[model samples]
Target chain A: MGELRLMKGNEAIAEAAIRAGCDGYFGYPITPQSEILEYLMAEKPYEKTGMVVLQAESEVASINMVYGGAGAGKMVMTTSSSPGVSLMQEGISYIAGAELPALLVNINRGGPGLGTIQPSQADYWQSTKGGGHGDYHLLVLAPASVQEMSDFVKLGFDLAFKYRNPVIIHSDGAIGQMMEKVVLFDPIPRRTDDEIKKQCPWATVGKTPDRKRSIITSLELDPGKQEQVNLRLQAKYRKMEAEEVRYEEIACDDAEYIFVAFGTSARICQKSIELARAKGYKVGLFRPITLYPFPVNPLRELSTKIKGILVVEMNAGQMIEDVKLAVSCSLKVEHYGRFGGIIPTPEEVTENLISKVIGG
Target chain B: MTEEIIIAGFGGQGVLSMGKILAYSGVMQNKEVSWMPSYGPEMRGGTANVTVIISDERISSPILNAYDTAIILNQQSLDKFESKVKPGGMLIFDPNGITRLPARKDITIYSIAAADEAGKLGILKVFNMIVLGGFLKLKPLVAPEFIHKGLEKSLPARHHKLIPDNEKAIEVGKDLIQPFTPAD
Candidate 1:
């Protein structure tokens, strides 16, 4: 209800985690995303809000802390850039297998090695598909602004718990480092411990006198039990597909050409839309909010109406393959982007769109 | 809804600070905004740049390839990005920073001697504010007052004493930009 205040994208994520009533935050310091840890350090919401923030020695330890806390059915979160997130793959896969409701944020940077500090959306496939080898997916929410960086924590937790799964907030250096005005929540979050407890009865802090001991583990050695667990997970994913698929169709209603992009890349695509529109090209953008349960059905439908689909990413056409799989080979698809810390500009995309699709 | 921009220069030349201030102004305007910096080891006293996206709506993405316009404090950044400047976009530069402006026919380039201006003002720390002031004076997407308030809020409380000097620095920066000339 108060006037909005300006905040950095990293600080925004920290605030959102606390506001989401997440009981704990475990993270290590990494540029672009370090402010998340710093914000938590400065705010220290522990005594007042019953939240715990720990700066782990490494990203691996941080995620295991998240695993430990989330296993007790407490709202928990951890964050890192691409390399650190890479270290967290094993934990993430374990969390997914255990069907735990937790959140992780990857403020992506350029990679293959310690590439550069600039923002890059190169972690697309790693986050959407399995970074850790297995048949699992993180409900990845891609944000283009600081507000989403803050708000997605709440949404991630809500959906994660709703589906009994782990969710990934896949942002990049752009979203993490940027500053924006955000209407921040009050000192205390809207949710309470009792509220979270009521929703998650399986939460294991210390068992009540009347209840039996609860064990949180992903291990199912028996073949039959593993199959049953996999089936249960598949069912949960099916439910998410049926009910939780989210995306935005910008100017696509009457569009002749569609540009598919997400996270920071999608923001540039909007600028491309403006440029293309001026050039008399009926260009539109399809931004996938959830990268995991990708808006496949809608993309397939759009393929039928659009002449071409241009998928722009920071990496070398990683997500383009997903778009192709979703829409099949009916429409001509192309990749227009950059890699290794180079950000693709609207002018470059505009040139590509005009030359390839607008009959240049 | 984003009013996107690029500010590029050598690392210590206060390039990131300009983007930070613009991003702060976006916050004061109550617009959804984000700031992204070159990640990894690019900050090792090298050609540093930042992109800021300020918008009114739930900004669809913070990532952009081309800027609406850009401000170059050094030649390396200009050389790196000048050709990629949009056909009709603006470029604010420091004469001390660049030997030659891009020869693009349609684009408008406003050259400022921000580094020298800061040196003359006896407030060198406000070098970034000078260009920020140029941004406001030339074509302010957000109100100047909003940015003024943003500076007050963004700077640390201990540095609040420097507010007057910084504001004055912006005022000086505003005077440096040549008023727009109409195309005959």
Candidate 2:
């Protein structure tokens, strides 16, 4: 708990990174998320904490910079929107393969290509299903509130380092641009190089005479060794699934029907739940705070009682597949979504739920 | 109780800032609040709007359909938001640049020459503050004292000197409001 102030989600992300003791930030500005870079430059956390903040020439260059920084055992981060994140996929895969802990944020905008600047949850599959080229997973955290947008920065970094894996904070334009009251935490000290070396022994700091040189690379030319690496990564993901499946179940104890959503869609579903309940429908909400380690077991258990599960998203049903798989088709699962930056109102979500889930 | 409001005007009319101030005022009063603006290129010179909610309980969606209050500063905003006000809700407009009057019969409508008042005061930037005053006069969801505190929070310290003139514009706006009477 700390001082409360009204701030935008993007601005909160920048401040939280500073407070979280992040060592460096390399980013290229993009719409709806450019404020993150702007805030960092304006605040000049470099003077306060000696953190490095660089406006890279491009998204490709920025993510590579993050890889370079993370390889040195430094807590580094970068943020981009839809297309920019797409450009960072190759570097992200490299970082994941090297097991370099870093934080990546995608303040999503509408896109198959360079779509609208408005918000969209279309990046769900890109974030959770391994946007990069490899058998890898990013610990994806979806934040619905401006406060969660701030809080997840620290959480993502902690989890990233804990598992020696990259973490992604998947947010949308609505959450990124919207302003709300946020309680900021006290600043943490950036980890010194000795502490980083002690924790991340595999990190590529200058080779000392006391120990062997650690080469950071994804290239395991041997197929068997690569298979072993893949197995190890899978084991880590499985552990994450069992231990780190974060979700919120709202009024599900007596609910006959439930809406499953994440990020901004969860906020809209909260209102839909209220509207449905006012009309005497036993509706509740299930929000996945962690998108990658989907809350399969809890959802499967909840599906035993609920008659139907409606997945709502700001895209063309990206998360619905995960919801359906989580429930194992045990309960009737349906999806309601609005894509291409057309945000569905609570009334619209409510109407769709009544007609699709309740009536069907 | 919750007040879901939409304040819209042309870019640079301080529409979004008004919503931010109101939201900050709500926070100063220890209430839950959300302020969401229609961001992007539309904010340059076209119609701009912001949705603000202040409540005693936790707020849900920041994006909303109907609003408890609509404070429109121009004809474009009036045309866009006049229908979005909930029944028994309030619509406050500057009426300086608006061409068509609001035709809704179910809501309470009020007019204030906020832009003209700002002109008279020679501080054109306070026009949005004037309209904010009109909305607050009808529905003091956040108290004026909290609003003063909100101004302190919303504006950078360097521009704080304008707050008093903004406060004065608010008073002038309060005095200029004319409550609409329904015709039989």
Among all candidates shown, the one with the greatest TM-score: 2
Candidate 2 C-alpha lDDT tens digits along A149-247:
999999999999999899999999999999999999889999988898898888888899865799998999999999999999999999999899999
lDDT of 1: 0.81
lDDT of 1 by residue, B50-165 (tens): 87777777654455556678888888888887765677888888878456655656678787778888888677888888888888787777787887777777788898998888
- Candidate 2 per-residue C-alpha lDDT over B57-166 given as tens digits, one digit per residue, 9 for 90 to 100: 99988999889989888898888888889999999887786668888899998988878878877889888888888777778788889999999999999999999987
lDDT of residue B116 for candidate 1: 87
Worst 10 residues of 1 chain A by lDDT: A184-193
- Per-residue lDDT tens digits of candidate 1, residues A1-360? 844766778888998888767789999998778989999999888876878999999999999999888887788889999889999999999999888888999998898777777788889889987899678888989987777787788889888888878899999887687666677665546356566566667777567775567778888899899999989888888888888888999999899998999877888888788878998889999999988888999899888998998898999989899899998878788888899877787778888887775663
- Sorted into a CAPRI-style docking class, model 1 comes out as medium
Give the top-scoring candidate (lDDT): 2
Which stretches in model 1 have alpha-carbon errors above 4 Å? A1-3, A185-197, A354-360, B1-5, B26-36, B52-70, B81-92, B95-114, B140-144, B176-184
